[model samples]
Target: MTAPTLFSPLKFGAFELPHRVVMAPMTRSRTAQPGNVPTALMANYYAQRASAGLIISEATQISPQGQGYSFTPGIHSAEQVAGWQGVTRAVHAAGGRIVLQLWHVGRMSHPVFQQGHAPVAPSAIAPNAKVWIVGEDGLGGMVECPVPRALTLPEIQAIVDDYRRAAERAAAAGFDGVEIHAANGYLIDSFLRSGSNRRTDIYGGSIEKRLRFFYEVVDAVIGVVGPDRVGVRVSPHITQRGMDCPDMVATTLLAARRLSEKGVAYLHFAEADWEDAPLVPEAFRRDVRHAFGGAIGVAGGYTLDRAQAVIQGGWADWVAFGRPFIANPDLPERLRQQVPLATPDTSTLFGGDARGYTDYPRTA
Candidate 1:
């Protein structure tokens, strides 16, 4: 097979992607203190990888209350906005198109990271798993997740407004667009899954009701940046953070259909768990594509060959690479030229300095 099928030009939303390869969002936890603002080093990191067709930034909090871990960037403050402006300017100067991923961790937060406050969620249920958090010893560490308080109706509405505000900030900071983080057992995913949501209110119970918060969020974000500049991510069956749906197939199809009718830019689906997990079945991928007529990006455990096959088979318009891109800054060039990729240093993945963040050299 010929190399560079992944490098073919493609149009996604309002931007023309230089190639079908995307730098998928991965949390780096490298922001500054007090406000968790983006740093100058971060700007340099993104600028170095500007060759990517599209750069989806690491998950950024929409509000102070939305934070689940310490040192992750936020978009709700002037300092944070100004800090990100530097990043966006650097990326654009290097000829890269970038989008900010708006995120809220919901119940996946420890009280220590919450600034002496309890984390909020669709219900007062605690996750059955642990969450990564900063340790008092100053080194990066992990801790057990605290039980979160269920948000009142008014609180939920306020969160929607926060997302709207975050989108405005992203646009002002010069991002090409904004991607709502509705996947991976986050705030929106909490509501979508029956296991995490045990509320007896308008935002819970039936699938339609569970989807209400996400739809409202989309409407709010679109209001701020318009529908053409918005995108949403969904993880149907990754099963992370204690999230599971009784009917994964039906729920995913319904969510895709609803999002398609909304006229957003694109829908990103994490078809399956990436770590030693089965690939998404062919029938399910086709079903999702049929339900969602607009552009689709499939991620999670995709190699160069599998990515090309997915696009050629008409299953997805784009394929996002996470770990591969981490170790290879010139991932697209390497794939196109069939060059060997560098091994990623897993020890430096999270809460690291410039070492793992930007020290990855390109293929010579």
Candidate 2:
């Protein structure tokens, strides 16, 4: 039999991934009310996509203050842990490996979403963009992001503790591992980007300083989950929600090299915004691959052929699919069979029930 390309087995950290395809972390805002707990519907949704080598759950808030959107699952409280237990149970029952994505929105949150509290960040700077918030109508809505208060040194340390606690809770909840979401304009990403972090303290200024916050958080998470079971996500060129690195090459290279030194499980890098951005330059990909000795997973607007080429070329160890996995629940099966994918319904992408969440048809 011919060897499988996308279906080939691979080793990522402690787990032996059955395939090289991972379900990327995506926020759907469908958790249950009052504490943003994961629902039974979410369990069904993840279980349905078990064929992938691994599943990274939606970016989950580490604490109440970490939340920037309504109805998203959290891993802080006992109730939240119990809710995710159901999700992890379902995924494991279907013979799939799953990881909980730990997140903090920082200035990407509105006071309304923070329950009348100000948003927090490494520095007090307003993102030149907007964030999705819950409107007065009790539905998902958009609001201009407000200037966040620069966190005090003590508060910054506290947030690191929050990540440690969340990681411990994730393991107790039965997740195979945890992915630190240091990407996509969140708190850690904000600190890493010079445009967002304007602090004068040791946590800002030069590249080494800018990465201090991330290093602390990673240390805390690894202390809880161990380095072998923790992965991190980063997006160097993605200027989402008003985040842009002045020098993409320098910033990403520094971040990648630092992460590699930490000895985390894997590094998931989204080279560009998916909509209509340019492909990551081959040279840049190769540079990152060389910098980070650990496993690498690349996402954003990748097709089967392109993904296979990236893996075969040694640029990345695995490929993650976001929209493709959402629209095609059995994406791995479809790719193996060489079938066309179903179009994603952008209308039902966020703030919906199970219609767009779990109702995507599986291949027969």
Candidate 3:
């Protein structure tokens, strides 16, 4: 079977993309520290890769309490929203579309980012993950995540309101769309899995209750941006974040069906990419396709060949690249031309200046 080229045009909601390659949201932690706001340099960085069919911005914290690391941009502040305006304008000026990834780290956080307050989650349980925090000397390193304070019912409702406000802020920042970052064991992901959500309230317990928080959030955000301009990201295979609950698969599949019923733009799943990670089962893919009527996207360490295979097999509508897009601003053209690939310097992947960022030279 002949596979569609990476440069093939595709439909993402109401937008018609020039190609199907997407820039996956990656946390670079490069925003200005004092304000945790986007910079002109960051604008230049995303503009360089504006050729992608869609560019999902780095995870931006929805509120100050939602922050988990140093130097991460936020969507809750005026300065941050203005800063993102430049990013969206740059991408649009370069003839591209962009989506803001709304994030709340939940229990995957340290007190440093939370202003001495413990991170909040659906339950008081911990994820046993290390979060990056700046020490007294201003050097960033991983610190143990503490057991979070369980959010009260009212607090949970307020958080959903925060998601709505963040979506409105994203629109005010001139973004074409918004993506709910419910993946990778964040706040929403914590609520979806039994491993973390052992609560007895309406927000936990049965699978239906576990997904209540997610549904409320989706409904709130959709009210602001409309379902056509909205998307949700989910990861059903990540165990590193202590999210491997017994019902993880069933829960995420149900989440997909519910999102589809709501008529959102698309569903994106972050496949496990570890060296020996288990592949996403074909059965899961078939069920996901049948359960969701909209387009589906897959993101991970996908190469040209594997990406082509997935598209050819009709399993995914687009392939989002992470590390590759870090160094290859013109990734779509690079795949189209079959040229030499550039490697990303792991050292500068996190918080840093433009040294390992916009400085990466693009191929003509």
TM-score (all chains, Cα) for each model: 0.96, 0.96, 0.98
lDDT of 3: 0.90
Write candidate 2's Cα lDDT for 160-266 as tens digits.
Answer: 99999999999999999999998889899999888898888999998889889899999999998888899999888788677877875687788778777878889
Q: In candidate 3, list every pair of residues with a backbone clash.
A: none
Clashes of each: 0, 0, 0
- Residue pairs clashing in model 1 are none
The per-prediction CA RMSD against the true structure, in angstroms, equals 1.9, 1.8, 1.2
How high is the CA lDDT of each candidate model? 0.87, 0.88, 0.90
Give the poorly placed runs of model 2, Cα more than 4 Å off.
1-4, 274-276
Per-residue lDDT value at 98 in model 3? 95
Q: Write the per-residue lDDT of candidate 1 for residues 1-364, one digit (tens) a residue.
A: 6434677888756878988989899888889887899999899988988888889999999998888876899999999999999999999999999999999999988777677988999999988767677776878667778889999999999999999899999999999999999988889999989999998899999988988999999999999888778888888868867887787568779978887787788888875645677667889888988898678898887888988998888888889888888889888888888888898899988887999889988776
Give the C-alpha miss distance for residue 314 in model 2, angstroms. 1.3
Which candidate has the highest TM-score of all? 3
Output the better candidate (1/3) by TM-score. Answer: 3
Candidate 3: where is the Cα deviation over 4 Å?
1-3
